[model samples]
Target: MKNMVYGAILALQFLTRFPLPVNCSMDHNTLKWALRFYPFAGLAIGGTLYLIYNLLNGLLPLYMLTLILLTLWVFLSGGLHLDGVMDVADAVGSNGSTEKKIEILKDSRVGSFAVLSVIFLLLWKSVLLYAVLDSSENELFIIAIPMMARFQALLQLFVFHPFQNKGMAHYWKQHLSMRDVIIAACWVLPFAITQVTLIILFSLQICFSFIFGKWAVRQFQGVNGDTVGASIEGAELWNLAVLYSLFLFGIV
Candidate 1:
């Protein structure tokens, strides 16, 4: 019980900018068990977004609401996953050797590719959020997208080899276990039970994660923290797109 509490705190601290009630040690075992709480972190993020949406839904214009939501989203996560997206973009655009690409991923300096990718990603998410705002099923989406994205990250941790023997991804992989994945999957049950469509969408997201994982391995020889971040951001974007498409087609 104590470990679970510490693990949840560690997961929240790692995943979000939320203030912790108390400080926790960064022991390797605690960090490893924290992987199981990744979905809970996502749930926290989504719940906050949902609360903000309701608070501002009628007070602000759709575009403005979306802008604020996007800002809050970034603020909440400290742009962690988006940073991954940019790093991956820079690495991929470099067109260099695997070693060179890995070097780019490690570089702190942002490049043109990173800038462009971030812009497009924010724009895409903004548009999708705007569209979904008026849908009746928006709340479900709000609560599920982040959970699914984080779950995808967990899936990647289980399925892919870490590119390096150090860094956050390596540490997570070292501690990660099949039980962690199973527990994470259990977190999705409530959302899945509420709607069969969610189950199908989650299945698709899982499939995409595996496909993306294989591609990451082929390109980088294995996954890293950057790829995990990229996967989270990509998964969220994919989930939003799918939800919006279903909304448009009257399928949701």
Candidate 2:
């Protein structure tokens, strides 16, 4: 329960400038420990965003609200993971071997591919949110999406080996176990039962992680933090695309 609280606080930290009592002190299971309860962070982000969406629903135009929500989200995290999404996109598009690929990802200069990818993701997400808001006023679904996205991230922590480097992923890789996986599954499963649509979205996200992570491993020799971020970002957008497409075509 304490860990879950930390996780919620951590999520708030990611989404906003809330100060946390705990520091990233590199303690035992600090990274893995922090991430183990990370899904709760999603709950926080989703809840806060839902509130904002409701508060601004009639006060602002749909596009403006969409932009404000996304901009606030990015600002909250200082665009940390999104930057990873951009870097990974740039590296994947470039002609390079594994070593060269990592070098390209590490380069601070943004490429055209990176810019294009981020723009598409932001725009796509904005549109998706707007559509969903139009159809459903229940803000819980908004919260659920980020919660599920973080849950998808947990799978990579358990399933894939990160490329060699000392970072948060390394910490998670070392201390994470099946017991942890079971625990996380327990928390997320009940939520899954609440909506068939959620079940499909959750299942789709898991499928993407294996296929996407495997592709990253094959192409880059192993997964890295940037690749993981890209996977999360991609999975969220892909899930949104599928859901919205179904709505657009009246399929589901």
Candidate 3:
């Protein structure tokens, strides 16, 4: 129980920019166990955005609030996943040898492909969120999307071997006995079962992760930290698109 609580705090610290009041140990053992709390960390981030939306919904124009929410989302995550999107975009756009692509992914310099991808992704996400906000007053979409997205991320972490540094993945596979991932899924499964839409989303997330995982393996022969980050951002976009489509058809 104590480790689970520390794991949750460690997850938030690693996953977001939120200021925490207490300090905790960050050893590899703690971090590997902390993987179970990633989805809840996402929920905390999304829940904060939901709270802000309620507080400012009427005071600010919908468009303004939409931008504010988007901005806050980026700030909260410290653009961690966005960095992944940029790196992977640059790598895939390079279309070079596997070694070359991996090298490019590790490069800190941004490329034209990185710039274009981030612009397109953020633009589409903003447009989608604006539509969802205007069409419905539901808080579940915002709160649930991030939670599911992080579960999607956990899928990457749990399922793939690291293409570069293999330490974390190696330790997790060795020590946790895979129950840690089950615990993470347990955090999400209850909420996913509450809605048929969520169940569909969960299934889709699994399918997408497998497909993406294969592609990553074929491309670099395995996954990297940036690639994991790419999966997280991509999952969020998928969630937003699915939700918006459901809303457009008056299904959710």
Best by TM-score: 1
lDDT of 3 by residue, 1-252 (tens): 667678888889878888987687766567766788888888898999999999998999999999999999999999999999999999999989999998998899999999999999999999988987888655666877788888777777677777766544444434443677788888778778887777777788788888887888898888777787788888888877887787788776
- Candidates' lDDT values, in order? 0.87, 0.72, 0.82
TM-score of 3: 0.92
Query: After TM-score superposition, what is the CA distance of residue 249 in candidate 1 from its true location, in Å?
Result: 2.6
Please provide, for model 2 over 1-252, each residue's C-alpha lDDT reduced to its tens digit, 9 standing for 90 to 100.
555455445545643454576644444444444566556666666677878888998999887888888877666556777988999989888978888888898788999999999998998888887786666534556777766777777788679888876765665678778776666666567776687667777788788889988988887777877887777677767777766765677655
TM-score of each: 0.95, 0.88, 0.92
In TM-score terms, candidate 1 sits at 0.95
Rank candidates by lDDT, best first: 1, 3, 2
* Predicted model with the maximum lDDT: 1
Q: Higher-lDDT candidate among 2 and 3?
A: 3
